[model samples]
Target: MIAPLMKQAGRFSETTVDGEVVLLNLDDGAFFSLTGTAAEIWALIDGARNREAVIAELAARHNADHAAVAADLDPFLADLQARGFLAGA
Candidate 1:
């Protein structure tokens, strides 16, 4: 089983305007922009969900295969982790 995600490590707040996604960091003023599939995946990382669950949800939502979703998810998750937007499991 996949481990649970840590929500308390950081906080995320997002806003969409004119088809663009702006994700804000609650701890600091730092923010990032996401587009295309990155935006879709970003919306699914609620921090309450595990890596496996996020991939499963994305696969179902986008009608994609699990392996494909997992492959795409790794780098995105790594970016978020590196940016302090997501915590380690």
Candidate 2:
């Protein structure tokens, strides 16, 4: 099944802290601090990419196995979806 789009009403803002980016959810006052691989994956979640494309691109960029990346990404994506930071396109 395709992932659903992030809610339109949710507000997301990002800032760099000590050379790392942190994404914030203004509505609920939640924050996600991204670093290393998680940060890389988070950066790919524009509104234009599908799940498969994201997996492939991230795999190539990180020099990681596709299945492994997908495995790690599934829950992260789910959490972002749950938190309104990412929307499927």
Candidate 3:
């Protein structure tokens, strides 16, 4: 079976400055600021990878544990989705 993907949703504008990402949600006029690992995680959910794949890649890239990364990432992803920032979540 094909896995579910996390894809960007709604209309938005984003900019990166000093390694941090500032995102503006055009639909709702909400703004988000993502720094450090949060910025990295935002960049990874490009509609190409599933939740497990994202977790694995992040864990490997950061030399962190898969379970630990998943524990943190799951809630973050959910929040983004709940806020209409993500589709196919």
Candidate 4:
């Protein structure tokens, strides 16, 4: 089973500023900003890419350690999930 986190429909709007992705939640008018690698991660969650696929891409793109990136990604994704910015995995 390849489960991926999908961005919630009609829940948020986004803008990019100086390389950061700023997401605004429509429900509560909450604004969340994702920068650097986090922005890249956000771009990958389009209902097509799985978590491992995202981790792989991020690792290759940054020449980063896979485990380390995964460690960071998990919590960030969880935060997004908690905020209702994501539909589910």
Q: lDDT of candidate 1? A: 0.77
Model 3 residue 71 lDDT? 92
C-alpha lDDT (0 to 100) for residue 8 of candidate 1: 36
Q: Which run of 10 residues does model 4 get worst, by summed lDDT?
A: 80-89
Q: Write the per-residue lDDT of candidate 1 for residues 1-89, one digit (tens) a residue.
A: 67665533447777898767997888787889989888777667675688899888889988999999998889878887777776773
Q: List the residue pairs that clash in candidate 2.
A: none
User: Each model's C-alpha lDDT?
Assistant: 0.77, 0.74, 0.83, 0.89
Q: List, residue by residue over 1-89, the lDDT tens digit for candidate 2.
A: 56533433457888877657798898788887888877766666665566787899989987989999889888988887777776542
Once superposed on the true structure, which residue ranges of model 1 sit more than 4 Å away at CA? 6-13, 24-31
Please provide TM-scores, in order, for all candidate models, with all chains considered together: 0.72, 0.77, 0.86, 0.89
Candidate 3 residues 23-67, lDDT tens each? 888888899898988899999887778888889899999999999
Q: Which ranking of candidates, highest lDDT first?
A: 4, 3, 1, 2
Clashing pairs for predicted structure model 4, backbone only:
none
Off by over 4 Å in 2: 1-10
Worst lDDT run of 10 residues, candidate 3, spans 1-10
